[model samples]
Target: MTAPLSEQQLAEIAAREAAASKGPWLEGARRGNVPTLYRPLTSGDGVSTYPSVLFELTSVYGGPGDMAFIAAAREDVPALLAEVERLAARVTELEAEHPSRFAATPAEVDVYLRSILAEDTYLRYQQAIGSEAVREAMDDATAYRNCDDNASKKQAWRSGIDDALGYVDPDGDVGPYPSNLLCSQHNGFGPCPGYPWCTPSQDDTEPGDPS
Candidate 1:
């Protein structure tokens, strides 16, 4: 005679399948883990508090105001990813068109680097948003989602953000890196820097000009 599978065992099996189906998404969750968003961006006293890997997971899987917001993000992630990818491609194309501009100065290069990195991270995060694992994690019991567990989810979440942040923190309170780049350059806002989650500041008037 054969034995039937228990509900717990069945749930575990389903979870495993979901995670494997979306490797990149799980990776993002693992990197973005944070205990909470109140953490600062510095390291020591009087300094900014650096973002923890756990925060990323909580931000994505964790609902808005203790509610589930993953479903809506799930719907939006594809479009967001597409937008970032297109932006990144445009950056590369523009760089090719104006090689001299990108090679102008260190500050300009820094700006370009930040912009590209931000775009790249945006794409990766969107990939995570579409991941079966994240969706599974969000759809899982509200209690389970809150539990710390292995911290893998959090780490994965940050990884996506870190992909484009360079030396910056993804969920840090310093504002989006792409926006910071714009502020450094144009000194205004309204531009996207061609990436998702990156809002321009009051300084971003002209597009990035390495020259």
Candidate 2:
């Protein structure tokens, strides 16, 4: 996948765009049956004319389409660059507001998900057990899990689950289950307790639980 443009790259593009000739450039009369581009000029009299030739399509392969694209780019590029910068700023603001939505890597996403699971577990345990120590321990575990260094190391089970879910092994090499089958327990209500988020019922056994 193509990496997102960095701020430096965006700034460099903006610099190039700023250095380019001021636009709203116009298509001028064809020269020798070849299309031409011109920058609009206005004198003190306020009469506008396309006297300044910006580009002349002299290449044997060049056509009207090429000339049109080049002329349009003069305006399109700046507008697009401005929009990119604005969106980038908005994304930064949104990431500040909701960091989970902006998880850029698999490891980061895993940590984000795990943190949510931890919070949910904490809340459930607090309600069920009513113990402050359990809550504190859950908080500690969440903080430890969220450390940047531990993100990748903690994701081993993600591959296993993905394999089980047929994401990695769609051919069913990981298990007998078909890729198309959805868990009966996870029907619209929420994820089952066998997974990370749910609380197991008395009849339910957590995945990989020997009991």
Q: Which candidate ranks first by lDDT, i.e. highest?
A: 2
Where does the lowest 10-residue lDDT sum fall in candidate 2? 174-183
| 1-211: candidate 2 lDDT, tens digit per residue | 2245667866755565565445555565665866454444566586764645334334443445554455566765765677778778889898788777554553354345445755445335323332343444455556556666555645743443443344322344422111121133455323233433333343365543546
lDDT of 1 by residue, 1-211 (tens): 1234456755644454443322123233232453222222344465544545322333433334322223334533554466567767778899888787635653455455556666445434434433534444344434444768667866664554454343332344444333232332323422345333333332343443322
Local distance difference test, per candidate?
Answer: 0.43, 0.47
Q: Give lDDT for model 2.
A: 0.47
TM-score of 2: 0.25
Model 1 lowest lDDT segment of ten:
21-30
Q: How accurate is candidate 1 locally (lDDT)?
A: 0.43
Q: Estimate the TM-score for candidate 1.
A: 0.20
